[model samples]
Target: MATLPVEYLRTTRLFREKIGDVEIISFEVPVHKYFSRNEIPYLATALDVDFRKMENLITDMKYGRVAVEKLWAYRMDADIIRENKKVLLPDLASNPVDGEVDEFEDAKVLKIHVGPLKEYVRVFVRPRQGFREVVVYRKPPHPAFVRYVAYL
Candidate 1:
């Protein structure tokens, strides 16, 4: 329906002139990515990735993660995770249950699953419509973390 904001369009155009758009935009693992600094080690262990080597990759911030509007358009499936020996806190096990109205107020609950090992994640688009974020209920073993080592 609506394209990006005017300011974004302007800055993004300037950014394009400065540096061309890329198929994948990447950045080092944010030091403050998790709520607390203490949670990094455990997350590294669970994802089977080095804490220092982790990173966040989005298709492109300007056009968003994908050509599609939906935020969850790009995903790493269980098979991919398992093959890489990258662990998922909330695996198919843990008796994960979808979220109800109370958990995520106002915003549409895309997917929220909870388990005993604090294994679950709630990936949802905010009520503001264009906002997007990933929420991991458990911090120590971040449920929505993965390490992607690729030549591309």
Candidate 2:
């Protein structure tokens, strides 16, 4: 398979270190856009969080007041939008649909852990005929979420 480039809105230098005549710079880079064989994209944000906070994140997602049609995450892949699972993001209830739109109320959230340190929150939506199963991983809000919250 061919490699794919990750998407980023921007980048910034974090810090610089110098030793004698050599200097090194550090940058806080965005995570790669991981893709399935079918080209579905997902990005996982690393959070050095405790179990309690992870639980809280899930609880908040289960019962959070989300805005309508807001762009919570940066990458809104075409495959995800086409699946009509875009509602799984903090943005929902406003995306145009053939009929009634799917909201968080119409989905199920599953909390899963891969190892002692890796945990994932996945949301599954109602299945539609002739379409792939809709599964969206609930990640931490993108940096833009706070930066543009007022405008959104």
Candidate 3:
């Protein structure tokens, strides 16, 4: 885990999206920061996905050309952490914990049917620790409590 810069904590914008009973909150970190030695403390490993392919998948979903499925499981894959990094975005990436929704106790799973490719990242959203909410957004879900929810 990387320690976020104090400035990022203060200046980074946290975006919130509400999907049904879910509230998805997220923020973007400048991708360039990944290379900065000074910002290393605040960075987590970026998702190494085929950016163009994933982008196309997202576009297809937006146009109703692709199928999306919601799967509920007790655990989520560690790779899910990468989705929150927003590595597909041009300038920004996601912090792993940004999607954990630590504010809620109930965690639900959202599985986007990106074929059966084991290499693709899986994203999910659950309520914050105390409230009942689910999050859906342009970005992916954050796996905040990964140790507890991590899939073997």
Report, for all candidates in order, the number of backbone clashes.
0, 0, 15
Q: Which candidate is the best by lDDT?
A: 1
Worst 10 residues of 1 by lDDT: 9-18
Can you write out model 2's per-residue Cα lDDT over 1-152, one digit (the tens) per residue? Answer: 96653322233334443324433332332222211111111111112234344333333332342211112333334343454222222211122112122245544333433222123234344333432233445343221111011101
lDDT of 1: 0.29
Report, for every candidate in turn, its global Cα lDDT versus the true structure.
0.29, 0.27, 0.28
Q: Which wins on lDDT, candidate 1 or candidate 2?
A: 1
lDDT by residue (1-152, candidate 3, tens digit) is 97632221113455654434544333433333112221122111212224444334333444444321112211222354453343221112332222221222444443322222221233333434432222222223332221111110
Candidate whose TM-score is highest? 1
Comparing 1 with 3 on TM-score, the higher-scoring candidate is 1
Which residues of candidate 3, in runs, are more than 4 Å off? 1-10, 34-152
Model 2 — TM-score against the truth? 0.22
Please give, for residues 1-152, the per-residue lDDT of candidate 1 as tens digits: 98862211110110111112212111122212121222233233333446554322222325443311212211234354354322233322223344433345654333334433221354332333443333333233222343221221
TM-score against native, each model: 0.25, 0.22, 0.21
Q: After superposition, how far is residue 90 of candidate 3 from its true place, in Å?
A: 18
**Can you give the lDDT of residue 97 in candidate 3?**
26
